[model samples]
Target: MIETPGILLTILSFMLVIGPLVFVHEMGHYLAGRIFGIKADAFAIGFGREIAGFTDRRGTRWKFGWLPLGGYVKFAGDMTPASEPSAEWLALPAEERQRTFQSKPVWQRAIVVAAGPVVNFVVAIVILAGFALAYGDVRMPPVIGATVPGSAAALAGLQQGDRVTALGGRSVETFDDMARYARIRAGERTRIDVLRDGRLVSRDVVIGTELQRDRFGNEYRIGRLGIAGGKPIVVRVGLLEAPAVAVKRTGEIVSMMVETLGQVISGRRSVKELGGPLSIAKVSGEQMSLGLDAYVFLIALVSINLGFINLLPVPMLDGGHLLFYAIEAVRRKPVGPDVQEWAYRGGLAAILALMLLVTFNDLGNFGLWKNLAGLIG
Candidate 1:
């Protein structure tokens, strides 16, 4: 049976988690544009027909849309959601044009476009840093307590009490570090370095893969070295050091994301494993039920994902705008409107197709497809 959080709670949690992130993302663009004296026409929390709004003293209309999917900041002289320039607005008098986004220099335009995703990363770092400040760090040594029989480690001749020093040419300091390294190297031949009885030993092994199910019955395929940690150690973090720790944690998470994408592209993983807004809602509800701490951690994770996705070089995304800016910087002029319009259309179609695919995956995960098939039969 498919178990899920109550529908009411799911909707509430989805809004609670997504709304602020969207606001923060758009706010990044707004602030960056303001810095360059670019006037915003509107700052909206969502798309489509506005539900409620007010014009700020600066003449920027602040509005909330009925749909809670995503948001945008409409700057003066922007003709499309992609933030393409409008020729009519660009043709305004010098005094009037000075306050429009198209009037800004290319460098300023790049920063304004990049600020949205960059702010998402900054927000993620802040949330993660808060956790580090509160919980401290685990200082587990990379000592192998035992190896599973017939598993990759044992098959490679790994033994108990071996102090793991490195994996795949990278230094591994602690058990957690080794686990992290192993998690990404599944099914790959790797060189593992260890100190065996005070002597250096190296083993070449093909890391094993495992399909594991969580309490929620969610299946995940992960890498495994089949070796357990020796013991536990924990250390408190200083106030000055927590941010640095969080930064490192953020970098690791980004690395994992990049690796996962590479795995998917290389056909080592399936695209069906990808999640969408529906998945976000389900996970949000589940995490919220776990507790506030769990929910907050989810927020940080989703923040990083949002930042990373926006940085992709797909049209209609922040990175696409930056790509255009880079081209303009090189060509000494902006791309033609006809070319930009076609690119935006392609981007929108790609985004929609992806949404449909992930939504299909979500339904499969919820067993909805099976249920419908049973009914039809």
Candidate 2:
């Protein structure tokens, strides 16, 4: 069983990782609202009972809530759960409703809604750049450091110290590139070009396959090349190049997220592979055990995930709100409140169901459920 200290550490780690990400996301909305002359009634850091709060000079109540799950920005004249204003708001005196979100121009409203997710992306980019600049980028070159005995690479006469110059005629610059190529070509015959002992060599390699588990406890066959690469070597970059590195890193993260999501949706990956807060806590705790760099990298990766997920066009998410704004922009009118209300209700249900599913997977992955089942058995 995980100890008390371990559980507490996991909880604290979850808060640390999630709190700032949530804050940055909400701040994007708050700042954009203010910029568009919309009055924000409250800017909260969490949900549920307010633990502490103070009203700013601008009349925005800044508060820290007891529940650390999520937060929101309550706009002026928002009558229905602090989202876009309702028709009742429009019926109010012109001056009184002026600051209402729905009263703003469509473009401004879109900006305000889109800002939240955009801020998440921005935060991810900044964090990536900062880490890259401070620690220098460390990555493995496309060189084979080791090969498992009897593995495909070994069987194909591939040996340690062989640099993979190309795979299937595609130039491989990094180990990751080679891995991706191998994964995509799994179970297929492929030609490889290697530099061995300063001599160019060619070989036919068949990618191996193995079962992999996702965070959701779902398993799938993933292509594997039975070769390991050396540890990443730090590559320093100039100040001017830091931002470029950050952008590149962010793009790579986004691409990975897209691929993962596509695989999940296509049933190539299991739904059990999804993770929730529990899984994140576990990962954070594990990273804490590794050291400061590992912890920071984990946090950055989570931040990127948070940002990318919010950008997904699902109801009750930031991206969903942005989608509504897009429709409003094109139609020159807001979506009907009834339509929005129904959509929100459905979205909330779907999100809650997903949360429960992911939570179940997390418990199973952590052996909590299995232990309980064992006791029953």
Candidate 3:
């Protein structure tokens, strides 16, 4: 039912964006398993029927599946793609048992499970650094170039030449830092510290709210500081410095994600913001249209999200495996298979419900139901 001429572009963009990321994630687990001397039964990209495949010398089946959403590395003792242990795993010969994943030490298993997310974070940081090196960094100082006549900045006695030093106790190193802090607290009162004409002055300002709309017909209430920038000074850093800057940027992003999640959980943010694969496809297509740089940045952002989401303490995920390992380490024995099975079932149900909700949100985002209703009317 996708009638847009750009549908093909969307599909291609989705594949390009997700394919490498999923491959990287699974490869992390594959490499770690090999390093720990655990035997892998299969190293597969995607799920369902295999389109093409080959058996490696080590007896592992490496293949590409028909579906292209996600991938997995199935270790020898894994009963399913979720990496649960099977009866067959326990029934293996004593010699063969040594090579199975479950036969490995708990620490080894934890490392293998944790590697996927760790690699994802590393890859994102590297890619971001590369981009920073290529594009150069924006060196805009946090000085006020101008202020709206009737806006918050003017009300707060912020002059055009005043240099913003800090906001709400956080130091501002760049215009980005000021903008980031300002955008989240519409109509909230905060203290701004500035250097004006060789003197330091502190002023109280109430963040102003403005309604903004996107091309997709979505409207957002965003905080407006009413301060404008003149020109940004661009400086390209050495390769060594790029990685450090990239690490800082990545950490900032992760921090923001954690804060947003906490806000959502505590009822300060709306659940409607959660997205699924459909939303990703839409964004991927949008980024593709914006050119290669945007698309690459999008990939980096999604990669970070993937890595962080996998680390959440939910069963059937990498973090779930680590959680179980933690309990085993504490109690000196693994939880009963029945308990693990029930927990996995509950996790699967929660995941499915969340997927459905996000898919519904995607439909709403696309205006599918709204358009359909309009047509019917």
Which candidate has the top score in lDDT?
A: 1
Q: In model 2, which regions exceed 4 Å deviation?
A: 1-5, 68-70, 81-87, 139-149, 154-173, 180-223, 228-233
Model 3: residues with Cα > 4 Å off, grouped in runs: 1-5, 80-87, 161-163, 187-191, 195-204, 214-221, 375-377
Relative to the true structure, candidate 2 reaches a TM of 0.82
Q: Which stretches of candidate 1 lie over 4 Å from their true place?
A: 1-3, 68-70, 81-85, 184-186, 197-199
Candidate 2 per-residue lDDT, tens place, 267-353, comes to: 766788788988888777767766777787787788788878887777788777878878877887778878888888888899899
- Residue 11 displacement in candidate 2 (angstroms): 1.4
Best model per TM-score:
1
* TM-score list, all predictions: 0.93, 0.82, 0.89
RMSD of each: 2.1, 4.4, 3.0
Which of the predicted structures, 2 or 3, would earn the higher TM-score when compared with the native?
Answer: 3
TM-score, cand. 1? 0.93
- The alpha-carbon deviation from the true structure for residue 61 of candidate 3, after best TM-score superposition, in angstroms, is 0.9
lDDT of 3 by residue, 1-377 (tens): 22242888998899888888988998999999999888889988888899999998999998889987668888888765445567787788988888888888899999999999998899899989998899888878999999998899999889988999999988998898888778767887899999999999999999999998755445677888999987998898789999988898899899778877886788766788888998899888878877888899999999999899999999988888899899999999888778888888888898899999999989988889999999999
